[model samples]
Target: MAVPVVTGRHARLVRVTHALTTLCFLALVITGAEIIISHPRFYWGEVGNVNTPSLFDIPIPASRPWVNTGYGFVMPDQNGWSRSLHFQMAWLLVFTAFIYGTWGLRTGHFQRIASYYNTAQRRTYLLVIFALMPFMIWTGLAMSPAIVGTFPFLVTLLGGHQSARTLHFFTTLALLLFIAGHVVMVIRTGFRSNVRAITVGGDTQA
Candidate 1:
Protein backbone atom coordinates (compact mmCIF):
# COMPACT_ATOMS: atom_id res chain seq x y z
CA MET A 1 0.00 0.00 0.00
CA ALA A 2 1.15 3.51 -0.79
CA VAL A 3 1.67 6.00 2.04
CA PRO A 4 -0.76 8.92 2.06
CA VAL A 5 0.52 12.47 1.88
CA VAL A 6 -1.04 15.24 3.92
CA THR A 7 -3.18 17.52 1.77
CA GLY A 8 -2.18 21.13 1.28
CA ARG A 9 -5.12 22.55 3.19
CA HIS A 10 -4.57 20.09 6.03
CA ALA A 11 -0.89 20.94 6.13
CA ARG A 12 -1.61 24.65 6.28
CA LEU A 13 -4.13 24.25 9.05
CA VAL A 14 -1.81 22.00 11.03
CA ARG A 15 1.08 24.43 10.62
CA VAL A 16 -0.96 27.38 11.82
CA THR A 17 -2.40 25.47 14.73
CA HIS A 18 1.00 24.08 15.70
CA ALA A 19 2.57 27.56 15.74
CA LEU A 20 -0.25 29.07 17.77
CA THR A 21 -0.31 26.19 20.25
CA THR A 22 3.47 26.22 20.69
CA LEU A 23 3.55 29.94 21.44
CA CYS A 24 0.66 29.75 23.91
CA PHE A 25 1.88 26.58 25.58
CA LEU A 26 5.39 27.95 26.04
CA ALA A 27 4.08 31.11 27.68
CA LEU A 28 1.79 29.12 29.91
CA VAL A 29 4.54 26.72 30.97
CA ILE A 30 7.01 29.46 31.88
CA THR A 31 4.44 31.48 33.82
CA GLY A 32 3.06 28.35 35.45
CA ALA A 33 6.52 27.31 36.66
CA GLU A 34 7.07 30.73 38.19
CA ILE A 35 3.70 30.64 39.90
CA ILE A 36 4.25 27.16 41.29
CA ILE A 37 7.80 27.89 42.41
CA SER A 38 6.67 30.87 44.44
CA HIS A 39 4.36 28.68 46.52
CA PRO A 40 6.39 25.43 46.24
CA ARG A 41 3.75 23.39 48.09
CA PHE A 42 0.60 21.48 47.42
CA TYR A 43 -2.40 21.12 49.67
CA TRP A 44 -5.82 19.58 49.71
CA GLY A 45 -9.19 21.15 50.52
CA GLU A 46 -10.90 24.38 49.57
CA VAL A 47 -8.89 26.39 52.08
CA GLY A 48 -5.08 26.37 52.26
CA ASN A 49 -3.09 29.05 53.96
CA VAL A 50 0.61 29.33 54.82
CA ASN A 51 -0.16 28.41 58.41
CA THR A 52 -2.02 25.28 57.34
CA PRO A 53 -0.07 22.05 56.91
CA SER A 54 0.67 21.28 53.27
CA LEU A 55 0.01 17.94 51.62
CA PHE A 56 3.44 18.06 49.94
CA ASP A 57 6.19 20.62 49.80
CA ILE A 58 8.20 21.03 46.59
CA PRO A 59 11.33 22.37 48.33
CA ILE A 60 11.52 25.35 46.02
CA PRO A 61 11.56 29.04 46.94
CA ALA A 62 8.57 29.90 49.04
CA SER A 63 6.61 33.00 48.18
CA ARG A 64 7.75 36.15 49.97
CA PRO A 65 11.01 34.54 51.07
CA TRP A 66 12.55 38.02 51.25
CA VAL A 67 10.33 38.73 54.25
CA ASN A 68 12.69 36.62 56.36
CA THR A 69 15.49 38.85 57.69
CA GLY A 70 18.31 36.41 56.89
CA TYR A 71 16.98 34.85 53.72
CA GLY A 72 19.81 34.49 51.20
CA PHE A 73 18.05 34.23 47.88
CA VAL A 74 15.91 37.20 46.85
CA MET A 75 13.21 36.70 44.22
CA PRO A 76 10.61 39.34 43.56
CA ASP A 77 6.98 38.29 43.65
CA GLN A 78 6.00 37.58 40.01
CA ASN A 79 2.73 35.87 40.86
CA GLY A 80 0.70 38.90 39.80
CA TRP A 81 2.15 39.10 36.29
CA SER A 82 2.51 35.34 35.91
CA ARG A 83 -1.08 34.74 36.92
CA SER A 84 -2.32 37.40 34.50
CA LEU A 85 -0.29 36.09 31.54
CA HIS A 86 -1.09 32.48 32.40
CA PHE A 87 -4.81 33.09 32.05
CA GLN A 88 -4.34 35.07 28.88
CA MET A 89 -2.29 32.30 27.23
CA ALA A 90 -4.69 29.69 28.54
CA TRP A 91 -7.58 31.40 26.79
CA LEU A 92 -5.53 31.58 23.60
CA LEU A 93 -4.80 27.86 23.87
CA VAL A 94 -8.47 27.10 24.38
CA PHE A 95 -9.47 29.13 21.34
CA THR A 96 -6.78 27.68 19.05
CA ALA A 97 -7.43 24.13 20.25
CA PHE A 98 -11.14 24.52 19.67
CA ILE A 99 -10.56 25.67 16.11
CA TYR A 100 -8.02 22.94 15.38
CA GLY A 101 -10.23 20.24 16.87
CA THR A 102 -13.33 21.37 15.09
CA TRP A 103 -11.63 21.72 11.75
CA GLY A 104 -9.79 18.41 12.09
CA LEU A 105 -12.98 16.56 12.89
CA ARG A 106 -15.02 18.18 10.18
CA THR A 107 -12.41 17.52 7.54
CA GLY A 108 -11.19 14.14 8.82
CA HIS A 109 -7.71 15.54 9.45
CA PHE A 110 -7.25 13.40 12.55
CA GLN A 111 -8.22 10.29 10.64
CA ARG A 112 -5.57 11.02 8.05
CA ILE A 113 -2.91 11.61 10.66
CA ALA A 114 -3.88 8.46 12.51
CA SER A 115 -3.70 6.44 9.34
CA TYR A 116 -0.15 7.71 8.86
CA TYR A 117 1.02 6.60 12.29
CA ASN A 118 1.20 3.29 14.12
CA THR A 119 -1.59 2.16 16.45
CA ALA A 120 0.36 3.11 19.60
CA GLN A 121 1.10 6.59 18.30
CA ARG A 122 -2.49 7.06 17.24
CA ARG A 123 -3.77 5.96 20.63
CA THR A 124 -1.32 8.23 22.44
CA TYR A 125 -2.35 11.21 20.32
CA LEU A 126 -6.03 10.50 20.92
CA LEU A 127 -5.56 10.17 24.68
CA VAL A 128 -3.64 13.43 24.89
CA ILE A 129 -6.09 15.39 22.81
CA PHE A 130 -9.38 13.97 24.13
CA ALA A 131 -8.57 13.03 27.71
CA LEU A 132 -5.59 14.91 29.12
CA MET A 133 -6.31 18.34 27.63
CA PRO A 134 -9.92 18.41 28.79
CA PHE A 135 -9.02 17.20 32.27
CA MET A 136 -6.25 19.79 32.52
CA ILE A 137 -8.63 22.55 31.49
CA TRP A 138 -11.22 21.38 34.01
CA THR A 139 -8.70 21.25 36.84
CA GLY A 140 -7.40 24.72 35.98
CA LEU A 141 -10.88 26.19 36.10
CA ALA A 142 -11.54 24.41 39.40
CA MET A 143 -8.58 26.23 40.93
CA SER A 144 -9.86 29.65 39.91
CA PRO A 145 -11.79 31.57 42.55
CA ALA A 146 -13.76 33.50 39.95
CA ILE A 147 -14.67 30.34 38.08
CA VAL A 148 -15.53 28.54 41.33
CA GLY A 149 -17.82 31.40 42.31
CA THR A 150 -19.70 31.14 39.03
CA PHE A 151 -19.72 27.35 39.06
CA PRO A 152 -19.40 25.97 42.53
CA PHE A 153 -19.79 22.43 41.26
CA LEU A 154 -16.41 22.58 39.52
CA VAL A 155 -14.48 22.61 42.79
CA THR A 156 -16.91 20.18 44.36
CA LEU A 157 -16.41 17.79 41.46
CA LEU A 158 -12.64 17.99 41.89
CA GLY A 159 -12.95 17.47 45.69
CA GLY A 160 -11.56 20.95 46.47
CA HIS A 161 -9.64 23.87 45.05
CA GLN A 162 -6.35 22.61 46.45
CA SER A 163 -6.96 19.17 45.01
CA ALA A 164 -7.60 20.78 41.66
CA ARG A 165 -4.37 22.73 41.97
CA THR A 166 -2.43 19.56 42.75
CA LEU A 167 -4.01 17.77 39.84
CA HIS A 168 -3.17 20.69 37.56
CA PHE A 169 0.49 20.44 38.54
CA PHE A 170 0.63 16.75 37.75
CA THR A 171 -1.27 17.23 34.52
CA THR A 172 1.28 19.83 33.50
CA LEU A 173 4.06 17.34 34.14
CA ALA A 174 2.25 14.80 32.01
CA LEU A 175 1.92 17.30 29.19
CA LEU A 176 5.63 18.08 29.32
CA LEU A 177 6.39 14.39 29.06
CA PHE A 178 4.04 14.10 26.12
CA ILE A 179 5.67 17.06 24.38
CA ALA A 180 9.13 15.59 24.89
CA GLY A 181 8.07 12.29 23.41
CA HIS A 182 6.34 14.01 20.52
CA VAL A 183 9.44 16.01 19.64
CA VAL A 184 11.63 12.90 19.81
CA MET A 185 9.26 11.04 17.53
CA VAL A 186 9.13 13.88 15.05
CA ILE A 187 12.91 14.00 14.87
CA ARG A 188 13.17 10.24 14.50
CA THR A 189 10.60 10.16 11.72
CA GLY A 190 12.18 12.89 9.52
CA PHE A 191 12.53 16.34 11.02
CA ARG A 192 13.31 18.32 7.89
CA SER A 193 10.69 16.64 5.73
CA ASN A 194 8.01 16.89 8.37
CA VAL A 195 8.85 20.52 9.09
CA ARG A 196 8.72 21.38 5.43
CA ALA A 197 5.40 19.61 5.00
CA ILE A 198 3.76 21.47 7.85
CA THR A 199 5.41 24.82 7.32
CA VAL A 200 5.12 25.17 3.59
CA GLY A 201 2.80 22.36 2.52
CA GLY A 202 5.64 20.55 0.84
CA ASP A 203 5.24 16.93 -0.30
CA THR A 204 6.85 14.14 1.71
CA GLN A 205 7.69 10.56 0.81
CA ALA A 206 6.67 7.71 3.08
Candidate 2:
Protein backbone atom coordinates (compact mmCIF):
# COMPACT_ATOMS: atom_id res chain seq x y z
CA MET A 1 0.00 0.00 0.00
CA ALA A 2 1.20 3.52 -0.84
CA VAL A 3 1.59 6.10 1.89
CA PRO A 4 -0.95 8.89 2.07
CA VAL A 5 0.01 12.53 1.54
CA VAL A 6 -1.49 15.41 3.51
CA THR A 7 -1.87 18.87 2.00
CA GLY A 8 -3.64 22.09 3.03
CA ARG A 9 -1.42 22.37 6.09
CA HIS A 10 1.80 24.11 7.12
CA ALA A 11 4.50 23.09 9.53
CA ARG A 12 4.78 25.00 12.79
CA LEU A 13 8.16 26.38 11.80
CA VAL A 14 6.75 27.55 8.48
CA ARG A 15 3.93 29.42 10.15
CA VAL A 16 6.31 31.08 12.60
CA THR A 17 8.58 32.26 9.81
CA HIS A 18 5.59 33.43 7.77
CA ALA A 19 4.34 35.56 10.64
CA LEU A 20 7.78 37.04 11.31
CA THR A 21 8.29 37.87 7.66
CA THR A 22 4.92 39.60 7.53
CA LEU A 23 5.70 41.75 10.56
CA CYS A 24 9.20 42.67 9.42
CA PHE A 25 8.05 43.45 5.87
CA LEU A 26 5.26 45.64 7.16
CA ALA A 27 7.69 47.70 9.20
CA LEU A 28 10.08 47.94 6.28
CA VAL A 29 7.40 49.28 3.95
CA ILE A 30 6.20 51.88 6.41
CA THR A 31 9.70 53.14 7.14
CA GLY A 32 10.64 53.04 3.47
CA ALA A 33 7.78 55.33 2.55
CA GLU A 34 8.68 57.68 5.38
CA ILE A 35 12.26 57.80 4.13
CA ILE A 36 11.08 58.56 0.61
CA ILE A 37 9.31 61.66 1.78
CA SER A 38 12.69 63.19 2.73
CA HIS A 39 13.79 63.16 -0.86
CA PRO A 40 11.71 62.20 -3.88
CA ARG A 41 14.23 62.82 -6.64
CA PHE A 42 16.03 59.93 -8.35
CA TYR A 43 19.10 59.79 -10.54
CA TRP A 44 21.67 57.51 -12.13
CA GLY A 45 25.50 57.19 -12.33
CA GLU A 46 28.29 57.66 -9.76
CA VAL A 47 26.84 60.69 -7.99
CA GLY A 48 23.52 62.44 -7.36
CA ASN A 49 22.17 64.98 -4.89
CA VAL A 50 19.95 68.00 -4.56
CA ASN A 51 22.10 70.00 -6.98
CA THR A 52 22.59 67.19 -9.46
CA PRO A 53 20.27 66.88 -12.42
CA SER A 54 17.56 64.42 -11.41
CA LEU A 55 16.36 61.76 -13.82
CA PHE A 56 12.94 62.26 -12.32
CA ASP A 57 11.25 63.61 -9.21
CA ILE A 58 8.00 62.97 -7.39
CA PRO A 59 5.78 66.02 -7.58
CA ILE A 60 4.99 66.05 -3.88
CA PRO A 61 6.79 68.31 -1.44
CA ALA A 62 9.85 66.83 0.20
CA SER A 63 10.12 66.43 3.96
CA ARG A 64 13.49 68.20 3.80
CA PRO A 65 13.62 71.76 2.64
CA TRP A 66 17.16 71.24 1.29
CA VAL A 67 15.69 69.02 -1.40
CA ASN A 68 14.38 71.00 -4.37
CA THR A 69 10.82 69.64 -4.56
CA GLY A 70 9.58 72.79 -6.41
CA TYR A 71 7.15 73.34 -3.55
CA GLY A 72 7.38 76.13 -0.97
CA PHE A 73 6.53 73.93 2.01
CA VAL A 74 8.00 70.71 3.45
CA MET A 75 6.45 67.74 5.10
CA PRO A 76 7.44 66.75 8.62
CA ASP A 77 10.83 65.05 8.40
CA GLN A 78 10.59 61.46 9.58
CA ASN A 79 13.76 60.35 7.83
CA GLY A 80 15.89 59.95 10.95
CA TRP A 81 13.68 57.58 12.89
CA SER A 82 12.31 55.87 9.78
CA ARG A 83 15.80 55.07 8.51
CA SER A 84 16.72 53.55 11.87
CA LEU A 85 13.59 51.42 11.92
CA HIS A 86 14.02 50.42 8.31
CA PHE A 87 17.59 49.25 8.90
CA GLN A 88 16.68 47.24 11.99
CA MET A 89 13.61 45.63 10.40
CA ALA A 90 15.52 44.78 7.25
CA TRP A 91 18.06 42.76 9.21
CA LEU A 92 15.31 40.91 11.06
CA LEU A 93 13.71 40.00 7.76
CA VAL A 94 17.05 38.82 6.39
CA PHE A 95 17.76 36.63 9.41
CA THR A 96 14.33 35.02 9.23
CA ALA A 97 14.77 34.29 5.52
CA PHE A 98 18.19 32.77 6.11
CA ILE A 99 16.85 30.39 8.72
CA TYR A 100 13.88 29.36 6.59
CA GLY A 101 15.94 28.93 3.45
CA THR A 102 18.52 26.81 5.21
CA TRP A 103 15.88 24.60 6.80
CA GLY A 104 13.89 24.30 3.56
CA LEU A 105 16.96 23.14 1.68
CA ARG A 106 18.12 20.75 4.40
CA THR A 107 14.69 19.10 4.70
CA GLY A 108 13.67 19.19 1.02
CA HIS A 109 10.80 21.50 1.97
CA PHE A 110 11.13 23.41 -1.29
CA GLN A 111 10.55 20.23 -3.29
CA ARG A 112 7.71 19.18 -1.01
CA ILE A 113 5.82 22.40 -1.78
CA ALA A 114 4.62 20.84 -5.02
CA SER A 115 2.19 18.81 -2.89
CA TYR A 116 0.64 22.01 -1.53
CA TYR A 117 0.86 24.71 -4.17
CA ASN A 118 -0.10 25.07 -7.81
CA THR A 119 2.31 26.23 -10.51
CA ALA A 120 1.59 29.90 -9.92
CA GLN A 121 2.21 29.73 -6.19
CA ARG A 122 5.45 27.79 -6.66
CA ARG A 123 6.64 30.28 -9.25
CA THR A 124 5.83 33.21 -6.95
CA TYR A 125 7.68 31.63 -4.06
CA LEU A 126 10.71 30.80 -6.15
CA LEU A 127 10.82 34.26 -7.68
CA VAL A 128 10.53 35.97 -4.31
CA ILE A 129 13.04 33.75 -2.51
CA PHE A 130 15.59 33.44 -5.30
CA ALA A 131 15.38 36.73 -7.14
CA LEU A 132 13.59 39.69 -5.55
CA MET A 133 15.04 39.30 -2.07
CA PRO A 134 18.67 39.06 -3.11
CA PHE A 135 18.22 41.94 -5.49
CA MET A 136 16.60 44.02 -2.78
CA ILE A 137 19.38 43.28 -0.32
CA TRP A 138 22.02 44.19 -2.84
CA THR A 139 20.38 47.45 -3.79
CA GLY A 140 19.66 48.31 -0.17
CA LEU A 141 23.23 47.78 0.90
CA ALA A 142 24.38 49.74 -2.09
CA MET A 143 22.48 52.76 -0.76
CA SER A 144 23.91 52.54 2.73
CA PRO A 145 26.68 55.00 3.57
CA ALA A 146 28.61 52.68 5.87
CA ILE A 147 28.15 49.62 3.70
CA VAL A 148 29.19 51.46 0.57
CA GLY A 149 32.10 53.10 2.40
CA THR A 150 33.43 49.71 3.47
CA PHE A 151 32.54 47.94 0.23
CA PRO A 152 32.75 50.63 -2.40
CA PHE A 153 32.32 48.06 -5.12
CA LEU A 154 28.83 47.33 -3.91
CA VAL A 155 27.60 50.73 -5.03
CA THR A 156 29.87 50.70 -8.04
CA LEU A 157 28.28 47.48 -9.20
CA LEU A 158 24.85 49.08 -9.05
CA GLY A 159 26.21 52.28 -10.67
CA GLY A 160 25.80 54.60 -7.64
CA HIS A 161 23.97 55.40 -4.41
CA GLN A 162 21.18 57.17 -6.20
CA SER A 163 20.83 54.30 -8.63
CA ALA A 164 20.54 51.87 -5.76
CA ARG A 165 17.93 54.08 -4.08
CA THR A 166 15.90 54.23 -7.27
CA LEU A 167 15.96 50.46 -7.71
CA HIS A 168 15.14 49.98 -4.02
CA PHE A 169 12.05 52.17 -4.40
CA PHE A 170 10.72 50.11 -7.27
CA THR A 171 11.59 46.86 -5.49
CA THR A 172 9.64 48.00 -2.44
CA LEU A 173 6.65 48.68 -4.69
CA ALA A 174 6.92 45.16 -6.09
CA LEU A 175 6.96 43.69 -2.59
CA LEU A 176 3.87 45.68 -1.65
CA LEU A 177 2.07 44.34 -4.71
CA PHE A 178 3.11 40.80 -3.83
CA ILE A 179 1.71 41.18 -0.32
CA ALA A 180 -1.56 42.56 -1.70
CA GLY A 181 -1.89 39.71 -4.17
CA HIS A 182 -1.07 37.16 -1.49
CA VAL A 183 -3.83 38.52 0.74
CA VAL A 184 -6.25 38.26 -2.18
CA MET A 185 -5.16 34.65 -2.70
CA VAL A 186 -5.79 33.77 0.91
CA ILE A 187 -9.22 35.40 0.79
CA ARG A 188 -10.16 33.66 -2.44
CA THR A 189 -8.91 30.26 -1.26
CA GLY A 190 -10.96 30.53 1.97
CA PHE A 191 -9.57 33.01 4.45
CA ARG A 192 -10.63 31.47 7.72
CA SER A 193 -9.87 27.91 6.65
CA ASN A 194 -6.53 28.77 5.12
CA VAL A 195 -5.56 30.78 8.16
CA ARG A 196 -6.52 27.95 10.46
CA ALA A 197 -4.73 25.41 8.33
CA ILE A 198 -1.50 27.35 8.33
CA THR A 199 -1.64 28.31 11.98
CA VAL A 200 -2.82 24.99 13.44
CA GLY A 201 -1.92 22.49 10.68
CA GLY A 202 -5.00 20.68 9.38
CA ASP A 203 -6.91 20.09 6.20
CA THR A 204 -9.03 23.12 5.25
CA GLN A 205 -12.73 23.09 4.47
CA ALA A 206 -13.73 23.89 0.88
Compared with the true structure, the alpha-carbon lDDT of candidate 2 equals 0.83
Count residue pairs with overlapping backbones in model 1.
0
Candidate 1 lDDT, 1-206, residue by residue in tens: 22245443335667898889889989999999889867777888777767788888775555567333234665677889999999999999999999989888877778886886689888888889889989989999998789899999998988898999998998898989999998897688788886777677676543
Error (Å) of candidate 1 at residue 166 is 0.7
The lDDT values for all models are 0.81, 0.83
- 104-186, model 2: which lDDT tens digit per residue? 87777887775567899888878888889889999998977988899999889888888888888888878778878988988
Q: Cα deviation of 81 in candidate 1 (Å)?
A: 1.7
| TM values, all candidates | 0.87, 0.89
Worst window of 10 by summed lDDT in candidate 2: 1-10
Clash number for candidate 2: 0
Residue 23 of model 1: what lDDT? Answer: 92
